[model samples]
Target: MITAENLTKRYGAKTAVDDVSFTVRPGQVTGFLGPNGAGKSTTMRMIVGLDRPTSGHTTVGGTDYRHLKAPLREVGVLLDAKAVHTGRSARSHLRAMAATHGIPARRVDEVIELTGLTSVAGKRAGKFSLGMGQRLGIASALLGDPHTLILDEPVNGLDPEGVRWVRQFVRYLAAEGRTVLLSSHLMSEMSQTADQVIVLGRGKVLADAPLSELVRSWTTSQVRVRSPRAAELADRIAGDGVTVTSAGAGLLDVAGLPADRIGDVAAAHGIPLHELTPTTGSLEEAYLALTGESVEYKTKEIA
Candidate 1:
């Protein structure tokens, strides 16, 4: 598990990370989300002791990362995949990392196979593709078989198949009772992988909750209805806090009423309904709503 209490970071006169606090429990995948310049990188750096916190504290398990006797065996981290030495082969890189903490050579081989880098294990790190570099980074992180994993944009340059593999791999890790903290810009993938989310904006904690609760709190549920008597159904369902918009001759998009409630109303009025489907708000929608004002770099609209 990872815990942060009022963690803060400042560079010169600017505050990169404000007082933020959150707990990432074990046996679950927790997603970290924010727009650009939101201090997510700073926070992660602080967690791994790459940067010192100006105030408060953060810990992997119950001790600071710097204090862990065997840091690699306690927590695995992958902050940057491109930070490896350009001259070293992928296998050599993992071997070097394993040698640091007294990890055996066979464990390095195990991680290489586990991360699907077996074919390119002998290739130079500088010549590897973006996806292969990411795989190597992940292999290094898993070299020690740590109980906690912290990954930053692990799927940044992966293909569709690689993306799916990572999604499944992280979920599998969390299922084994390990703590996993993942950061990603892909909301659709995060929605499928994460059980809970902690959102940061401008160095402050904006929201932290389960994925379902966050979506429901920030977005509205909608139900799409198709019927020959669409106009009549719209008029019947129109009331306070309810909205109905016409899509076409036989379709109406409804908000503030569930499908079952609308179906009951249609049955009572003897309306011939062709379709009634409930559409819940997506994670992308909820993320946009939560971080709308927190976006630092806004693009201007083109005419």
Candidate 2:
């Protein structure tokens, strides 16, 4: 498992990560989510000891990345997929990473096969596509078969199949009792992939909980009603527990009540409706709602 306690970083006057603390447990996928310039990359760099923290501590297993006798074997990090030398072949890059920790060439072949880069393993890394470069990066990370994996935007430029392969790879690694800490701006993908989430905004944690818990805390399910007498229907629906608002022309959005119950109430009041449908909130919607007031860059809603 990877644990960070009040980890912070500062470069001159700007505070990048401010006392941010969270733990990534083994046997599950924990997503690190934030907007652009939310200090996610800075935090990942601190965890791998590439950037020293200004305060607090970060640990992989029981030791910091620098303190570990074999750092690569303790934690495999892929901060930048393009951090390799361009002239070398993909196989040579993995070979060099393996040699650093005294890992064998047999293990290099294993990671190449595992990452599905066997076909292009002999080609120069600089000539490979973005997808293939990402695969080679993963191959380098898996060279030591480390227990902890920290990848920042692992699926940045992949196709659909590459995305699926990454999703499965993270899950399979966790199933084998390894820790995977991944960060992305894609909330929809996180919803389908992560068991837990750590949400950040402006160098601080906003929410850290299970995915379901975050959804429940941030948003609510609603029912939409469309009728000719929209105002009167909305007024009637706005009683004890339910709150109603105008959604659009001749449409009302009602919350704090299920769709079936709303339908029953509307029918009992002799209300005419052209549509009555349940609208489930998306994870993206919930994320925006939670961080609406905290956006670093706010433009008017185009819609």
Candidate 3:
């Protein structure tokens, strides 16, 4: 398990991470999410002792990462895929890393096969493509078969099959009662892979909870209504903050109103209704709703 208590990182006058306190428990995948400048990378660095915190501290299995005699055996980290030596082959790179922790040569071959890099294990790191480099990084991270894993954008350059493989692999590790903390920009994949989510914005944690609970509490419930007089019904229901948008011909997407209320309004106005579907909410919508204000770069829509 990973525990961070009031973790803060500062660079001169700018604060990268501020008073961030969260617990990443074992046997689950905890997603670390944020905007471009939301300090996700900095927090991860602090967790692994790559970057020192300004005020607070972080721990892996209740011990600082730097204090671990053999960090690879206790915790695995994949912050940058390009951190390997360019002149070494994939197998040689893993062997060098394994050598540090007294890991056997067979374990290196096992991780190479496990990460699907067996075919290119003898290839030089400099010639590997971005996706292949990511695989090599994963292979190195799993070389020691550590109990805790911290991966940042693990599927950045992966294909569809590779992405699925990573999703399943992390989930498998979690099922084995290992701690897994993942960071990614793909909301759809995160929704499918992560059991819990921690959202950061403006160098602070905006929300942290189970994925289902975050979706349920942050996003607004909407009802999709299809009727002949869609525009009329929409106008009738448009009051205060209620929103109604036309999806297509005779289809209206209504928000801030329940499905039953929309049905009653249509029935009272003698409008023929074809469908009434309630959408609970989605992870993307919930993320935007929670971090909309914390966005550092805003783009104006072309109207």
Candidate topping TM-score: 1
lDDT tens digits, residue span 220-271, model 1? 8999999999999999999998999998889999998889999999999999
lDDT scores in order = 0.94, 0.87, 0.94
Each candidate structure's TM-score, on Cα atoms with residue i matched to residue i, is 0.98, 0.89, 0.90
Q: Regarding lDDT, does 1 or 2 come out ahead?
A: 1
- Write one digit per residue (lDDT tens) for candidate 3, span 1-303: 999999999999999999999999999999999999999999999999999999999999999999998999999899999999999999999999998899999999899988899999999999999999999989888888899999999999999999999999999999999999999999999999999999999999999999999999988788889888898998889998799989999999988888999888888989999999999888999999999999997889799
Model 2 lDDT on a 0 to 1 scale: 0.87
The lowest-lDDT stretch of 10 consecutive residues in candidate 2 is 292-301
Could you tell me the lDDT of residue 290 within candidate 3? 93
Q: Candidate 3: which pairs clash?
A: none
- Model 2, span 39-99: residue lDDT tens: 8899999888899999999999978888899887878888889999999998899899888
In candidate 2, list every pair of residues with a backbone clash.
Answer: none
Candidate 1: where is the Cα deviation over 4 Å? none
- Alpha-carbon lDDT of model 1: 0.94
Name model 3 segments beyond 4 Å from true: 229-245, 260-273
Pairwise lDDT winner, candidates 2 and 3: 3
Ranking by TM-score: 1, 3, 2
